[model samples]
Target: MSDLTFVLAGPVRHGVRLHAQALGRRTRGAPLVNIEDGALPPGPVHLHFTDRIFGRDALDAAERLAALVGTRPLSVTLHDLPQPSDGASFERRRQGYARVVAGARGVQVSSEHERGLLEQVWGACGDGAMPPVAVVPLPVDRPTRWGPPAGAQGSTDGAVVVLGFVYPGKGHAETLAAMASLSTGVPLVAVGAPSDGHEDLLTELEDEAAAQGRSFVCTGYVTDEDLERWTARAAIPVSAHTHISASGSINRWISAARRPIVTPGAYVGELHRRAPWAVTVAADLPAAIGAALHDPTSTWIREAEWDGAALPDTGTAAAMQLAAIEAIGLA
Candidate 1:
């Protein structure tokens, strides 16, 4: 059997899913099982982002599906927990997982922030029942520079790109506002799946950009090539995750594209303090972004060499979670 099977129950073709697969592959052939929405499994790690939209029936179904995985040292891991959208189902998902994993020791949350989220999730458990939730900081592949080739003039072009699952809370509007204040006519690239909430907001953004004579592109959903395309072309990538633990896309873009980043103080913000390439805008995201955009190459040379290996090459994050489960079982 593989070290762990990471079964993701979602639209399996997305960026997060793909990164999980790549990460799984790197983690000793740990299987990244692609199951339908409710079809879950007991494995070292489970990529669960449960929401009320999936409903109680689906949530209950997921619990049973996990039970069917036969209790082989499970570490049910929820990514981006306290899922920004739903609090109830997120509770159900974690509660259901506690039943499967039983002791707190087997349950592992991927992002450090998830530990508190799990505590809140356990409050829904009532009558005292909670699991041990250890947050393994998500590992990002080392960034590779995708900037211009040797003779490309666009290498010096000024642009600030924000890559993520775009929506109201994602701060797209704020990013645009930041660009307006910058001296350079900043080109902003908004990438990721645009939620319904951002639909009209996006149109307004494009119209404003056209009116202002600024350059902008919004790739609704980016494939792998598109991912590299946006990052390589960007001078700075804006990350304003309102409610998230950690973002795989952010890490991948950071590594593969190697641009300096303007990020909100999310889970692993501390690590960025040590790395020159990253700067956090905890209190004022837009203004922070403006600063970065105005000087994308500010500490370019210095930041270029800065790397925390904050995200190291862990073969499979799932495998590590699995190994933790196995150790738990022995105890």
Candidate 2:
């Protein structure tokens, strides 16, 4: 095992933090240090980083990461890296992320798509060479028998479900608009609450759904049991992220033995190429939703017991990350 200490930052429920925790669990005796403790442990450090997890904004997060890097060997697995989709903050966030990359001994991104984004945004470091970057795809848990089979007793007919935290670009609005055009009066349900600052978007969605004579249901936050139930019942599980570096939500659907309808993008395209049966890519949300509702069986895998062998699991990802960290040559 490498001598790298894994640094955990961000809220407990945050995706980056949860990923770090998952990796830490698989790393056995490797030290897991909380960044909030005000001091990082000595020696090489590994961090699962996103700007918002470290500070109020990208620039501030970069400064914080720089302070933490003082004299120690550091490597990072970047999440939610800035892209052209960031609009006004793209340049500023790119500069901040560049600073983080410059100070790192190595870098890890979850997908080749994201690595391409990193190369586009950050390019070469000051030495005219990019940091050692590795691609470690996000973990997908093995499919298990979670609840009753789909469309049993508790299923919601024709419901279009969007799982995970709702935010402005999370595709809730797009789903809402799509559902409005549909003749099916089924509700568009969000299985989780809105992201911290986007609460107003939920209200707007509700009002818009009402005005359009469609139903929209935000379950706020539900227990894991309830989430599985919702997933099992969803007629059409959809993931329509407008800006995504990597998506744990899509994997969540896969893990539940559900094939989610996703919007096309580099990451989604890569995922579809790898596991075509796991997701359906749709260029038009409304048309896709309509087609899916017309024949709900199109969103399911044929295998009775899927092992999720097509994608990396948490253990495999942790091992891949450890190998990458070891290649960085921590002293």
Candidate 3:
């Protein structure tokens, strides 16, 4: 019989589903089972991102799960508890989050920052009787292999690149402005399209790039294979995000290509606490890029040296998660 069973009540195509799939394959000794809806079979149930699955209906489901499980331990791994885009929705989600926090026997978070956020979210409820939280680094699914080697000299030949979804708060405009302000003309390429209503912002960024005689190209969503090719061609990768919590994109990029990265300072304190290979700078973007170009390998990916919290692959991540569940007395 399987010693652990992960209940991913969320959508089948979600990111957590992928993690569960990879973990199931890597785990040893204890057989692992994954199920969708209906009554959870026997054994402990670890609810994954319940809010994402049930949305406003999350509290009711959480309460039901807690009651149905009886004495069997019920734990939760919070993937995201985002404040809804609007006021009414935010209040509803907040209440739902409180209920889950109070009901679960234990909780798991990816980082210290995440734990602190959860405390702030549910601190006032039930006299702050929140479940104990175990911190574990989130797993990243990296490409099987890096594309052909980028030039070792790290010279961009006067071109700047930022890849990923072009959305508000992703620093797309700021990066373009930074590139334009460079003393030398450096073209900028953003390998993504504006999400939904953000199309105008893309036009604005393109115009800004053109005004400065720098070409800005929006590749409009590329496949994994193409992204790898684009990344390998760049002299330096820009891991720019104004706000993020345990970013999968940044982690994957840093792992796949060992080149130096230009990132926001806030990300340094939160994600890469001990990642000296990453260059964290706020403002003065041109200077930061120049520095990264000079020594691209300064902060090269060293999976073995990630603050003793290295999860180089999915298998290692699965082992860590299994150990955490056992630590909480759930397995």
**lDDT winner:** 2
Off by over 4 Å in 2: 124-127, 146-156, 304-309
Which residue pairs overlap in candidate 2's backbone?
none
List candidate 1 stretches off by more than 4 Å: 1-4, 29-32, 37-73, 83-105, 124-129, 146-148, 151-157, 196-198, 207-215, 257-259, 266-268, 273-277, 280-290, 299-309, 314-319
- Model 3 alpha-carbon miss at residue 219, Å: 3.7
lDDT tens readout by residue for model 3, 67-172: 6556656777776554433245556566667777676778887766677667767864435567788876666454444433645324545346676668776767
Model 3, CA-based lDDT: 0.62
lDDT string, candidate 2, 202-285, tens digits: 889989888988778999988879988887878889999888778999998988878889999889989988888789899998
lDDT of 1 by residue, 103-212 (tens): 33456666656777666655655236565566665665554553444542243256777777667667566677666756546677787767645577778778877766
Write the candidate numbers in order of decreasing lDDT. 2, 3, 1
Residue pairs that clash (backbone atoms under 3 angstroms), model 1: 26-315, 27-315, 27-316, 104-131, 104-132, 143-255, 144-255
